[model samples]
Target: MSAAADFAQDRDTLHFRGDLSLARLGSLPDQLDRFDGRVSRVDLSAVSRIDTVGAWVVHRFAARHNAQVEGLDEDSQMLFDHVVGAEQPVAQAPARPNGLIRFVAEVGAAAVQAGRTMYGLLGFLGATTIAFLNVIRHPSRFRFNATVQRFEVVGVSALGIVGLMSFLIGMVIAQQGAVQLAQFGAEVFTINLVGRLTFREMGVLMTAIMIAGRSGSAFAAQLGTMKLTEEIDAMRTIGVSPVEALVLPRVLAAVLMMPLLAFYSCMIALIGGGVLVWLDQGIPPATYIQRIREVVPITDLYIPLIKAPVFGAIIAVAGCFQGMLVESDAEQVGNRTTAAVVQAIFMVIVIDAFFAVFFTWVGWV
Candidate 1:
């Protein structure tokens, strides 16, 4: 049978003997842990067949008591040195900060992030402007086919849904207006309300929101995927300007399509309102059309026409900007796509409000 490991203490020194392998040194570990007496040195001259586990135990004991180890063979000494070198500090949890302090810190971080995002967006806008100027100088660089394809995607394909939604919204507005006006015996004024509201605000605003959700998200996802697959990098290597090749076409399509789409939406909505007015109040379609022309101002039509292209540009730019910034994994593509839709819609609404105030100030109200 193999001899068991043993240790004896003489004053400030410890003398160990026999095999110092893992299983053989079982009780020696427990003894070292239980003993609390001073130990200045450990003598291992008689030790035989020492292994890594045994060396670890000896090293821990010497370290705990500030003791020196001696009489080890070259192999055993190397093993002990490896164990000592492999030590790591234990981690401790940090204390929580005060609630108010945490809240202020969060607000400060949010403000800083917003400032950085604004800065990046402005830089992207400048780059797009430069690309536009370059394309203007060299008209041959424009991608006619790509822009046409985007027109189909961003405008023609969206008509059915946009028309349906505007039709429903117009019906709702006329019905509600009739209900309120009936009490005052002013049900005929519902036509004026529908015409004015849809032409000036709802037509372009609703179309902008729809396009943002549809085309803006699509732009971000497409470009983000290209970025992930290094297609954008390939374009750069081939001396192709990504902004001119991809972004300009999409933005131009949106800008050209939005006014047409908004006008179509307004006309469809007016038709729906006319249908509602005839069914609910027994008014003739002829009278409804004449009344709309008489009550709705020309300025109302111009408002949506003016706003549509701006809203479209914002949507396209926001989407392409988020997409070009994408990096890392497939998950980032999805996140950037969502960010694009949200950013476009928010900017559209804010601009819409500003337009409202400006127009009101200029006597367009």
Candidate 2:
């Protein structure tokens, strides 16, 4: 309970020893008042048994006089650091959340974020639709050259990848079908299976997936970069609508190219399937062609062809929307681009499911 504090002073330093108690807190202000803001350093290494109130007294004394204090014991130093550090205040250990509670909280947060994203997507879609309507009304302002360039980037650039994938898929389907059909003594039916599936589903789905990975990512990256650089804002500052200047051309290109790409994929897949059937199943080209003609009706071919453009539109719009939404730095561009592709593919599958149900109701499936 002793309040005695021994002190030694030099030109600029003050040294303290002995116990500092709570009762001396009132005098600390007076003690610092004598210094006249001139004391540069105070050393307190010799102090012992300081309580929380005593620590507060020391902290206030140092801060009010704007003098540096050193040589404090661990607890007092911690108190000093807490009062002086410019960073965030030190927090005591918090109780850990229960595992299930933590998980539910995380899920709820994710769901809220996802809902916001979906709302943003819907708004973008509405804006894009209005822009398209405007372009339709005033065709003179639409840049056909830019649209064509977008087509080349989205469509022509994807040809090699689409072709390779379709070919490999066709070969796999044909080989598998041939193996299974061999047991049924109907090896020639492999042609029909490969042809029908390739035309009806594989071609359109594979093309959409490929474009989602390629053109979708490109759109997001390009738009995200533009957004990051404020080029989108600059475009808005002028009379030009960003939707018309940026989105419309890309959307038009994707819609125009997807059907053609799907058709090309179908042809390549059929050819590859035919090759597999001819080599593995020992089916001649003419007989294989006859089997395909017998099994695959015109509706089967038309169904996927119709779905291709819709899938392409979904991918283009999703990519553009994600790009426009990016707010972080350049690193976020890749993340948004990935998100765009994944969402586009997911939408494609959902759309395909609807198409499947429709086709089934119409007796096409």
Candidate 3:
């Protein structure tokens, strides 16, 4: 075998001429080190029989020393090409604003968008309500099977999440009550706190928020996707009322499910709260039950239960309306889905506030 190496200082280059092989790998690094970091480039055009190991050694040596290599013959060049092409440069995207000013701007834009969406939603609700009234007068246009399916989606599918959240909320309230009451030797009062809080506020509030985030968003996305695909337009072309076919079913489903979910949540929360009280405060179930009996009035339970279906109606109407009003494309579907959840939560809270004030004024609280 013949092996030769030469250096050309004027050009800042090193030349390798050899039958390059695995055994040659060890000395290659030393040859590169002899340049003492002076040479900026390597020319390997005269190299022959360059194997994979030789190529890897050359590539690694050049990379480590921050030198560029070129001028390989065909066989050596193929190996060099594989080594060079294997490395991909990372691409970094431009940075976005991260300060408070950017946050305020984004929030402001979102608020404006929300306001516009609310207006569109109100219009859709009005139109759907009117169409439903018309359907009531006619009665033959409603599809019973489709309506049942919608009910199942809105009610049955939502039960587990609603029940689980309510149960945990109950547990939290009970634990909190137990902690406060224990200090005063009134640990038995945990049941009253759990029952009153769960029935009057947490039950309805948690149920509405859950439905808004889960079912409402799902409704908006489903309808928005349908609208984007022009399925709504096709329904209209077939002489089917889009409002009757889409909006009414979801609204009815939500209205039907909300009360059931609210009741479930209230019971679960109460049970959870009771468990916490029993475990932490040493309050027996009978004493806990008795305290709830004395403190929680019937009106408190009724108030939240009533609010649940109403909140459900709002969620259904708002979600369906936003979905139907969606314009543009798939991006709009996502934006509207988010909007549906926010609006549903906001409406639930606002309505709950109204109920609170009204109930207090009427001596229900």
C-alpha lDDT score of every prediction, in listed order: 0.93, 0.86, 0.81
Backbone-clash count (model 2)? 0
- Candidate 3 lDDT over 53-112, as tens digits, reads 667777876777677888876666877889777778799997877788799999999899
Candidate 3 residue spans exceeding 4 A from truth: 1-115
Q: Native-vs-model 3 lDDT?
A: 0.81
Report the C-alpha lDDT of model 2 over 1-365, residue by residue, as the tens digit. Answer: 65475566787777776666665545554675575645677888878656666666666666766768888867788876775564356788999899999999999999999899889888998998999999999999798898989988998888899999999999999998888888989877788789889988889998999999999999999999999999999988988999999999999899989999999999899889988878876778888788888898999889877999899899999999999988879989999999999999999999998998998998986
Which of the two candidates, 1 or 3, achieves a greater lDDT against the reference? 1
Candidate 1 clashes between residue pairs 3 or more apart in a chain or in different chains: none
The C-alpha TM-scores of every prediction are 0.84, 0.78, 0.69
The per-residue C-alpha lDDT of model 2 at residue 196 equals: 85
CA error at residue 96 for candidate 3, angstroms: 16
Using lDDT as the measure, the top candidate is 1
Q: Root-mean-square deviation of each candidate, in angstroms?
A: 3.7, 8.3, 8.7
| Model 1 CA lDDT for position 225 | 97
Inter-residue clash pairs, candidate 3: 170-269
